[model samples]
Structure formats: C-alpha cells, structure tokens
Target chain A: MGEDFAFWLAYLTNGKHLAFYASFRFTILAAVFGALLALVFGLLGAMARNSRFAPLRWLGTIYIMMVRGIPDVLFFLFFPLAFEQSVEWALSLSVCSAEARAGSAWPPCPAANLFFSTTEYLILACVSLGIIFGAFTANVIHGAMRAVPRGQLEAGRAYGMSEFQVLTRIHVRQMWIYALPGLSNVWLLLIKATSLLSLLQINDIVWWAGQLGSPNFLPQAGLVHGDWRWAYYTVLFVFYIFVTLGSEQVFRRLTAWARRGMPLEA
Target chain B: MGLLEAIWTDIQLLAFPALFNIYFAASSLPIGFGLAVLLALGKNSRNPVVSRLSSAYIYAFRGSPLFIQFFMFYSIMLALNPIWWRPMGIAWFAMSPLFIGPLALVMNTTAYTAEIFYGALRTVPKGELEAARAFGMSRLQVFRTVTWPNMIRVAWPAYTNEVTFLFHATALVYFTLPVIGNQKDIMNKATELFERDFNVFLHFSVAGLYFLVITMAIFFVFGLVYARMMRHMPKERQPHRPRLRFGPKYIR
Candidate 1:
C-alpha cells in the first residue's frame, strides 16, 4: 500500500506536473494583488460617494451601479480586449512610424500591434478582478462606515479633534469591526474570482489542470494517462475548499479580536 | 458589410443563443429552489450525520469555482457509461452538453440557494412555530403553515438576487462544456462573432447589453413579487435586510 502511494506521489511531483506550480503561484499572486487593488478602489469609491461635491458623488454612484448591475464574467471578457486595444491604439499614434501605419484598416501598423504575453494577461486579470470587486467592497465599506455610531464621531469632535483627526483616529479604527465580516466575504470571492483567470487564457491553475488531465493518445508525451480530467478537477475542488474554509476561520478569529472589549450590539 | 449591417448580422446570429440562455436560467431556478428546500431541511435536521453531510455538501459546492464545477460535472458525466450498468441500462448519461449543462447549473444553484434557505430557516420565529403547535397543529402542519411561508418570505429578496446571478452564470456553460451541434449561449455566439469579424468591442458589448437588460428585467419582476408578498409586514420590516455582502455570500 505504501509503495503504491509512493509511486503516485513520485508521478505527480515529476517534471510534467511542473505547470501545476506555475498555476498555483499565479493564482496566489493574482489574489493578493487583486485584494490590494480592491482596497484602494474601495476606499476611493467610498470617499467619493461620501464627498460633498455632486459630480464626485455622482461618479462614485454611477461606477458602483454599473459594476453591480453588469454580470462579472462579461467584464472578465471585455476589459482585457478593450484595455489591450486602447493601449495598442495609443501606441499606434505615438510610437509607430508613418510608413508602418499606412496599410491597415484598424491600426494599420505592426509596430502599434501589441500581443499580450501570458504575464501581461495575468496582470490584466488581476486588474479586472480588482475593478469588478471594488464596487462590492465599496458597498460594504460604506455600510460599515455608516454603522460606526454617530455618537462616537460627536464624541471625537467634543474632544477638540479636527475632522481629519476624527476620521483617521476613530472612524477608521472602529470601522474595521463592522467591516471585517464583509471584507472577509470579499476576500473569498476574490479568491474564487481568480479561477476566471483561466478564461482570460492566462494558463492559470484551471487551465493547467485541463491540459494536464486531457487524454494523451500520443505515446511520445511520456505520460499515457487516459482522460483524467475528473481527477484533476477534484484536486482543484479540494484545494479551493481548503483555502476558503481556512480564510473563513482566520476571518472569524479576526472578527472576534476586533469585537473584544466592545459592547455586544449586533 | 457596412458597420450597421455587420452589427445586425451579429445580432441575428446571437438570437438563438440568447434563447438558450433564457431556457437555461428559467429551468434551473425552480428545480434548484426545490432541491435547496430539501437540503436546507436536511442541514437543519436533528441528526448530526444528516446535518454534517448537508453542511459538507454546501461547503464543497460553495467553496469551489462554478466554472470548475461545470467542467468537473461534464467530465464526470462523460466518463460514466450508463450502458455499462445493468438493470437501468440506458445511455441517458451520455447525452449531449445540452442536457449536462443544465444539470451542472442546477447542482451549483442548489448548493447556493440551499444555503440561502438554510440561513432563512435559522431566523424563523420560534414563537410562531410554538403557537402553531399549541393550536394542535402536527409537525408537518406547523412546517407547512408557519415555517415554510415565513422562510420563503425572509429568503425572497436574496433568492431574487440568486436567480439573477444564476442567469449570469449561464454564460459560463459554453466556455466549460462543448456546445454540441451549434448549441451555444449568447456569450458563446458573441465570442464566435468576435473571432470571425475581429470586432471585439462591438460584439461583446452587444452581448453585455443583452445580459444587463435581462438582469434588469429579472430585478423588475422580482420587485413586483417582493411587494405583493411582503405587503403585510410592518414598514420597517418590509425594507430588505442586507444579507452577507458580496462573494459567495451575496448569492447565498
């Protein structure tokens, strides 16, 4: 029995399975970067919604509404193409020689034509995910900010703190307690959203799993496995469950810590 | 073709796929809702084994990507040969993506909607159930008359969102599964046009607009239902409670 286990382990850890590592690495990197970008977008969105100016508030509202109303997968497909083309178009005007630009109907210049490498696609995936999820985080943070007691802000003001001081000190600190649950939820979504990276043709884990599990009829590929996609997908299934459940536990602990010494008002 | 004519041709090509998208969503929601009620009941059962099993089922489905789930379901179904099994020796399992696509969507939606139902069940007022029992209602009667209606009422708002999200999810089917005999969803058709014409922005934009319009229609219909169903509640109670924010929880 132990020998059988060893054989399978050795097989999976071999050179052919090296692509799995790439998928795993990119998935984690995308999630981390996406989360950080989402934080920035969410903070800005919330502030804009709360702004005194009508146009700024309107911009934030429209951004959130459009994102929330649209299906995320559409954005997943649309953003990269739009972004890539826009970049290429800008480069065509500025970077391409006039001779190179003369023939093509669209851009008319090979110099302006940008073929996105896998790494660039991965970056775009992260940015797309960040932008899509940012709307959701903005909604959560806005609610959390509202949930912070008005009395607490007034108390800060009574203590002779300026508006900025009160916001930086009390509002931001207390908002975490309210926001942790929602933020954690977003984190899980962001992680799952990383799965869509494969759809962008980034060769992420899902793509690798599909390719590696496909039936290898050609004997020269060195592996003679039949279609084992189910097995590969099962591995991904368990990996995701473990990651999400682990995040859930961590968030629970964080929430508990945040709520410590506070009045139980929920 | 001129730009207007080209766009018109793309739209004509996408019409059938758009119909399939509606068919996929419409078929899954009710079936998933029924399965979800049973799963929710199982999760809320007194037996630890049943409850734990249901919880594990929910966790497994909710934790993984729906895209992966669709692929996994297709692979597993394709791998299984029902003809090899005796007694019920039918080849129904080996059917085309048309059949399997909805199966995947149903299973995934059931897991998500079950959690939503289970969460609502948790909040069913104990006093009402007690009152039903005190009035000589049987266990089934109490559940049917008091618990079920109240659970549905509480879950309606979230369920509306779930239905909309499930509609959005129909787009992923063709990406994961092989669309047999030109059977494709709107997204698939849009992708085909984009590849054929290299008009990335126009074709995809039209597809996106279709989805946005469908989602708005869903919201509008559900809003009417919400108004009628929730009319008896107090003004404060009628306001939709914000469930868990974003992510899997949003659908749940």
Candidate 2:
C-alpha cells in the first residue's frame, strides 16, 4: 500500500500531473466563462422570445429550438475547427494583404500559412463550450421566465413601474430562484462535457490519463500499470461523482436560501 | 450538374442511417419505458432487497455520465468475447456493428427513462388510489383501470420529452459505433463531410437542419398527444399547479 502511495505521489509531481492540474484550471475557467456567456445568451434569448417584435422573437425561438434539436457533441467538434478556420481566413486576408503590400516579415503572409496556434485552440474550445451551454441555459432560463407569474409583472405595473423596471426588479431576480435547479443540472452537464475536451487535443486531464496509461510510456513501464486507462477513467468517474454530489448539496442549500422570506408562494 | 450530383449522393448516404436512427429511437423508448416502469414498481415494492437493488441500479447509472457508460460497455463487451456474446450464447459476429451499438444506446436510455418513470410514479395521485380501493377492485384490476391510465396520462408530456431528448442524445453514438444503413446516420455522414470536404460550415449546417426536422416531427407528434390528452381530461383539471419547492427537506 505504501509503495502504491509512493508510486502515485511521485507521478503526481511530474509535468503530466502539472498538465492534469492545469486542466482543472482550464475546466474552471471554461465553466465560469461558459456560465457567464450562457447567462448573457439565455437572457437575450428569453427576452427576445418574449418580445413583441415578430422577427426578433422568431430568431431567438429558432435558435433555442434548433439548438435543442442537435446533440451537444457535434457542436463541440464543429465549432472549434470552423471558428479557427474562419478566424484564420479573416486574419490571413487582412494581414496578408497589408504584409504583401508592405513587403515585411520573414514568413510571407499567405492564406494556407495562417493557422491558429495551441492557445487559440484552447480559447476556441472554451468558446465552443460557451456556445453549446448557452443554448441549453437559454432553454432553462426561458422556461424559468415563463414559470414566473404574469401577475408579478402586472403588480409592478400597478405600482406605476415601467416594463423595464418590472423586468429588472421582479423578473430577473425571481428567475434565478426558479431557474436554479435546471441551471445547476446544466452546469453539472457542462462539467461532464469538459472531459470531451481531450478529443480536441487540449492537454486536459483525460488526455494525460490516456497518455500516462498507454503502453507507449516505456519510461514508466516497470510500474504496476498495465492497460489501466480504464482505471484512470474510473478515477475521473469518481471525481465527477464527487463534484456533482457536492454541487447538488450546495444547490439545495442555495435553493433554500433563495426561497427564504418568499410569502409561502409556490 | 456537379452540385446536383453531390446533393444526390449526400441524400443517398443519409437515407439509410436516418431511417436506422428513427427506428433506434422508437424501439428504445418503449424498451426504456417498460424497464423504467418495472424498476419503479420494484422501488415501490414491499421487499426491501428488490427496492435496494433497483435504487443501486438507478444511482450507478445516473451517477455517471453516459459517455463513460457507453465506452465501458463497448470496451468490456469487446474485451470479454472478441468473437461471441456470452449473454446470447452465440457468435457475436464481431464485424457487425449494429448489435452492440444499439444495445449500448438502449441500455443507457433504459437507465435514464427508468428514473423518470420512478419519479412520475411517486407523484401518482394518492386520492385516486384510495378511491379505486373503495370501489373494491383487486390489485391487478385497479392497476389496469385506475393506476395505469392516470399514470400514463400524467407522465405523457415528460415521457414525450424523454423520447425527444434520447433521440437528440443518440448523436453521441457516432464516436464509437460504425454507421449502419449505408452509413446513413446524418451526423456520421456529416462528420465524413468534415473530413472529406473540410467544409465545416456546410456539413454542420446540413446536420443541424436534419436535426431540426427530426425534432420538429417529434414535437409535432407529442403536441398531438398533448392535445388529445387535454381533450379527454376533465375541464376543471386543465390548469397545472405551480411545482412545489421540494429542495430543502427531500434533497438530503
């Protein structure tokens, strides 16, 4: 047992483990940024769906409806490559045109030469997470907004508050209370979805686990590891279970906190 | 002419896989629903062991993400018998991708839908059950007449959503499963487009459109169900009560 402990401890301090820990940071950054982006998108979507303008409402409704139709994995795979190429293309045209005219720099600016580096790839991955999660969050928030009573808004208007004021004060604040459960589930799903980042070659923990456990690691060959990628994945499973379980407890507490002092209303 | 030929080929490629997907979604739904109901009944049974086992099954499946679940089953099945499936006691026909892929999908759906049914069963009206008992119906008869109808009606909307959700979620199988039906599955073909033409926008946009159409069809069917259910329901019971706050007490 002690030897096993020593083995793991030694492994934990290496560059792979550093990358693994960094993956958690990336996951956190993705989650926080994704949540913020989703919230913005959700708000815009919900408001537009509720709006009087036909085209705006249609656009928002279509976005949410279409997003709900497709599996999230496609979005994850599609967005990064597409976005990268689009960005690169735009940059190439602008940059190459300027550089071509100026005749400057060692590497001639060309369309084929333009490519997103690793950091840009990571950023694109997060943006993909944000886009996919934003659509889900939109559906959740849209439902929560609908869940809020029309009477609340009418009462606000009865008190001479404008539509904007009613929305800001009554709707936005109360939507959180109603939306918390669904949003929490979405957030948990987002956490699980982050594991798919390894497929993007983003140097996530799962990627490292795949690397460290593969038989190709000749240096670490004499260790007790075999085709234990599954074991490493099992560790991820446990980590996710813990993350979700812990977050659920927090969500329940938050719900209680949010519901306090409400007039015994449903 | 070239563009027309390409479009025709794309449609031909998509035709079989799309049909297979439709069949997959339709079949798994009933299987999942039946499994869920049985599990729910088990959970509600007087026997503690039965209840506990059902609880464990639900928790284990629900506790983990579906991707991992799919991978584990796919790998383990491949590992255990490279040539034969022990369960069927027959040669697995290792080359045939159809068997395990759909099986994995159905198993995952069953695990999820079972939970949903269990939840709906818990919310079955107590007063109606008591009323049915007053009518002197036997257990099985009461279940047939009173319980099942009401339960189905009450659970229809949710069950419909689950069907749609599972259909949407089937897109995940592409990473592991080989496409059947001339590689017709829309996402699989769309993915091929990504690799072949590298036209990310065009392929995904088409895939997105296919998904939209399928989702609409699902919604339309469910909407009809909703309408029919509403028509049969008592006029006074049409309005839905606001969902109760169950977090604080029940969560722990």
TM-scores, all candidates, are 0.92, 0.81
Candidate 1 residue lDDT tens string, B191-212 = 8877765567889878877887
Top model number, DockQ: 1
The lDDT values for all models are 0.83, 0.69
Q: B110-161, model 2: which lDDT tens digit per residue?
A: 6666676677777788998988899998999888887777777766666666
- Scoring only the A-chain of each prediction against the true A-chain gives TM-scores of 0.92, 0.85
Off by over 4 Å in 1: A1-6, A95-104, A217-223, A264-266, B1-10, B82-93, B233-248
Off by over 4 Å in 2: A1-18, A95-114, A143-166, A216-224, B1-8, B23-27, B46-49, B82-97, B131-138, B177-184, B222-252
**What is the per-residue lDDT of model 1 for residues A1-266, given as tens digits with 9 covering 90 to 100?**
99989988987897769768757988999999999888888988999989999999999887876676567888888899889888887898898777776754565566777889889998898888889888888888988999999999999999999999999999988898998888998899888888888888788889888888888666576666778888998889889999999999999999999899887876
lDDT of 2 at B242: 15
User: What does the interface RMSD come to for each candidate?
Assistant: 2.8, 7.3
All candidates' chain B TM-scores are 0.90, 0.82
Tell me the chain A TM-score of model 1: 0.92
Instruction: Assess candidate 2 and give its lDDT.
Output: 0.69
